[model samples]
Target: MVLKLRSDFFHSVLLDEEKCKGCTHCIRRCPVEAIRVKGGKAKIDEELCIDCGECIRTCPNHAKYAQTDSMDDTLQRFKYSIALPAPAFYPQFQPNISVGKLLDGLLKLGFHEVFEVARGAEILAEEIKKYLSLKNIPKPVISSACPAVVRLIEEKFPSLTGTLLPLDTPLGIAARIARMRAMEKGYRSEDIGVFFVTPCPAKVTEVRQSSDDVGRIDGAISISQVYSRIMNMLDELEEQKSLQFSSWKGIGWARSGGEQESLNEGEYVAVDGIHDVMSVFEKIEMGELSGILYCEAQACVGGCIGGVLAVQNPFLSKVNVQQLVKRYPEYHLLDDREGKELVREGVFRRRRPFQARDVLKLDTDYRKALEKYQVIEHILENLPGLDCGACGSPTCRALAEDVVREKAQEIDCPFLLREKMLELSREIFDLASKVPQTMNEERGKQTIESNQDSGTATGESGS
Candidate 1:
């Protein structure tokens, strides 16, 4: 199959040309071969990247960045816009800044209305609880909330796709409800735009990659972008009007264990960060993490508040979210009528599994794969396992894979190829070191003359 580049599939961690030193650390570490060194800089191949935030954490130069939508885009789409702020956003502001002050800041930024994504979290918790009550599916349901984790299953672990929790993400569900309420107030659906205040790049990728069943969310604004705008408003804050906010259960989604707590299920384990999530998923795949009802995996460590794209200190956000949650009741009931309708309409739908790419040459032709595999094995056997990445490939295994694809050669290995060249040079020097000897008639003539002269002298002496 032709490897078509899907730019929409992923977003870049903004790579600053000035900061990059051409180190391939990110390129080498990426599970998918998404990073490419081009023109002395690391460039992300959007089609291959999953926006797992690995590159952001790994880049020593801090050059990687994610794109955010301008507020103008949201304002231009509709006469009125609703700011569907993620719970992670709360921590970016001061601890004393009430939710009402936060809402007022959103209004100052031109949002006609403001809604907490936490409320949407409450709805999701209820739905998950109902799902648990019914014993239809397999044990250890993987959380569908994390787009990166979901994509990982789609690409590397397709067999586990069925186990992914089939539900709309908190942001999507929240956006849906916000739009529904806006429409109930006699606002035109087309005129009302809902923008998600996102904490990570993965959420942006999710909105683009997932099917358009969750239609209410028009766009995403990164926390970093909104932080400055909100900060400016905070500077001018004096007397803030009071507004009723959603329950803490809705806002708890910014944290790692928020989802499980929202559902109040004792059988679930909440995990954060990509590496830890991968480890847990591995256990699930191995049938070791069974008997558990749900596995809430967040790719960003410490959950959404700790997302690479977020502006606040993750720890501070965690504390702020906890304080915010403490202010409201632990559990709040969602008017389930709209949520049930959304489920029946198939609007709030789960992403389906896409077919994996035939990366193996064997899938194309076994005979060709066999030939290539032999060549690859020979090259690997001679290679250094150091994975130094001097050959422009990530590791020895990657070089082997590239060799199979005819993209690289065995001589690309510096040490082994250098040694072979040294050996050949020594052999050539030995062959040239041999001296040629000649035996000639002139040598015999000289020896005969000397013997005659010596004999004549001896005869004269005797006389």
Candidate 2:
């Protein structure tokens, strides 16, 4: 697919120039170089930006923010838009709200249908089980649900591409199933738009990317934007009715360890944060960590509720989600035979043979890398190992990589250049000291021998 930014995908996170201090914190923190300082203010390069929201987390000025869709826009998609609430959505509305009451509030907003992405999560859970049963899968199969993480693999860690589970994310799968159910009910596809009440920009990007042919999920609306509308409606519907739907176990897939815990066994590893996930994935690929049946990876540190665009704090959301899950029926209680069958047929399969870059090319393609390697070796031979980013790169190795990448010259790195200068200065001083004293002593001996020869010649002439 020719990738382009979807206009409907709301970038709730934004760079506020007036507020930005241009610290370049966002620039360094961005897994992609999405944020760059231009004209003394940080700006997002929309083409390059995957909307990971790392900048949103790093900015002390709170300059980066997400753009919110007005309730008016959500309503415009249809005569009545259905709210596809993610399981993470439940925790945002507190003491006054129950998941059932929240569904009623969505109906109050004129949503003709309300489906939980968690129901899709149950289907996904079944699909994941079947995938695990397959032969010769990548070690610690990485979850591709998080768009920010996928984008990181695409850009920074292409080697991990094979490891990403290509299955359509639960939201996408659920949106498709939701739309199909709507069609079966004699609703036109256009008339029944599925809007995701999202907690993060990553989901927005996923909706825009639209990896599967399911062709559901029209747009993603940030939870922060719709919270007030949903909150007000909850107050209005005093005796709100809950929709008869799938078990809460399915909806319980909202948090970090949810997927791994749902599976409950196997050599599973659940990790959050893009950096940490990559580190673990590397070990898995290198065979340092093995025999992993599943890998639950979430981009936001604490998972979706910890998302940069989330209105509620993540720690509190975890507590709320746990309480909500306790009220949920156990997974074994659900009768999702069709979902399990579909998974066995490989209907919801993830694509494979994903890209791994040629890092070896950096050495083979240019002689300069070898030269830089030598310079790095020499620098290490002399300088202290304390890696300070005062040289502009994050570490000494990064400085060396920068030199090879032509991103920075060797002299730009102060520590390496300082060591070279010091070594050169010492050699020059030692050579200067050794040369003069030996030459002066030899000249003095020659002068004495000449005087002795002149005195002998004069005495012989007088005799």
Show model 2 residue runs off by greater than 4 Å: 1-14, 32-38, 43-50, 211-214, 238-248, 330-337, 340-347, 350-463
Q: Which pairs, if any, clash in model 2?
A: 11-67, 12-65, 12-66, 12-67, 13-65, 13-66, 14-65, 166-350, 167-350
Tens-place lDDT digits, model 1, residues 269-367: 889987788788888889987889988989888998888878888888899888888876645444468556877766456544444444334436788
Q: Each candidate: what lDDT?
A: 0.75, 0.69
TM-score of each: 0.84, 0.75
Model 1 scores worst on lDDT over the 10 consecutive residues at 454-463
Best by TM-score: 1
Query: What does each candidate score in C-alpha RMSD?
Result: 8.0, 7.6
Task: Give candidate 1 regions above 4 Å deviation.
Answer: 1-19, 36-39, 210-216, 235-245, 336-339, 345-347, 351-362, 365-375, 427-463
Best by lDDT: 1
Query: 243, model 1: CA deviation in Å?
Result: 5.2
In Å, residue 51's CA in model 2 sits off its true spot by 3.1
